[model samples]
Target: MESQVTNNANALRLFFTDDVFVVEDKSVQIVLPAVTEAVSATVSIPKVEAKEAVVVVENTVIPAEKPLPPSESYAQKGEILPIVEEPLQPKAFKFLGGNKKSVLILVNDAAYDVSTEQGRELLRKIVKAVDLATPDFALLNYANYKGTTYAELHQFFKPQIMLSFGVEASHLQLNLNWAGEIIVHETTRIIFAPNLHPLDSDLSAKKSLWGNLQKIK
Candidate 1:
């Protein structure tokens, strides 16, 4: 009912002017012409086609990787295992003399073959000067028996006098720095000197060794 009243008020505004005041007798009448037929509007919409989805698959082959064998399997493949070196067996003490007088003579000469008669000629002369022979003392090459301890030598040779040449007391496992000195250790007279191979031409060293040898005897 309120909407109807609003529509009627809008219609009255179109007929009345703001500046003019009209009396009932001076009012003008307006009539709008009507159409004989009613008109209708029609809208057309376009149609879209529906499509099915396509999928592609590929067939690929991957080779399997061979696995590694255990450490023991190496032997089956003709491959040797890592060489674990055994502890160096204590070398059997090889001496040139009979050691009748319990005198141990040591020399370090890897270059010269002391086993030969000509090679040991200098050693023969040195022993002869001290009034000794091959049978009187044990001649040992320190080069061959490098890691031999003092206890091992003492047990084997039972040396009363150890005349070492070209080797130090420490080489025999004796910790003393008694090189070029004559000292009695455990009743064994030890004299360390330069290599006798060079002493053939060294007169002063030979004289000094001889002087020490006399006291030991």
Candidate 2:
């Protein structure tokens, strides 16, 4: 009991002594950034660069299709151009899907759905004539692609060749010979094919069209 009293007295003395440490109740201040200031400081967005000046392409005619040379014996064969080796049945047939540039387009005004039997047949011949599989091609309608200029199209698709089917499709923008002649409207090389209406039964037209397609590549 006496020792407890002594310890208490010692603690009291220490508290009163000037050498002992003392703590003050001082308030601390904290600063926070405003929402707008935080956002401006933290976030950054990039701007898109403007497009280059447009190219004014004067109408330059593509080289005319030459007569079929000696090696291609398919020219002399009967005007009937058969797509497949064996007989083709009427079941669902699809011949499209391939790498780009093989055909930037196969524009037509007829709106012939290639999903149908007759359309499939024509597409087969067209694909075969180019010596490319159906997958490696693209099809367009004149009505749809009228807005984009030829130079923009060339810059984007950079097609190795362009094939236009039917008169309206060819004449829409491309100044081509309407007689199913393969011609160039400008710097781009194009194949101006006959309208699908007459080409359905006309084997001679198919032969001639197929003959012209061989010139591409």
lDDT of each: 0.77, 0.59
Error of 2 at 69 (Å): 76
Candidate 1 error regions (>4 Å): 1-91, 115-119
- Candidate 2's C-alpha lDDT? 0.59
Candidate 2 deviant stretches above 4 angstroms:
1-98, 109-112, 146-149, 167-170, 178-180, 185-187
Prediction 1 TM-score vs. true: 0.53
Scored against the true structure, residue 10 in model 1 reaches a CA lDDT of 70
* Clash statistics: count for each candidate: 0, 4
Q: Which tens-of-lDDT digit does each residue in 23-132 have in candidate 1?
A: 68646665668766665655566666666666666666777877867566536666777899775444468888889999999888887546345436767776887789
User: What tens digits encode model 2's per-residue C-alpha lDDT throughout 37-134?
Assistant: 44446555677889898999899999999987669666566777666666323322122355355575544443554334665577676777667765
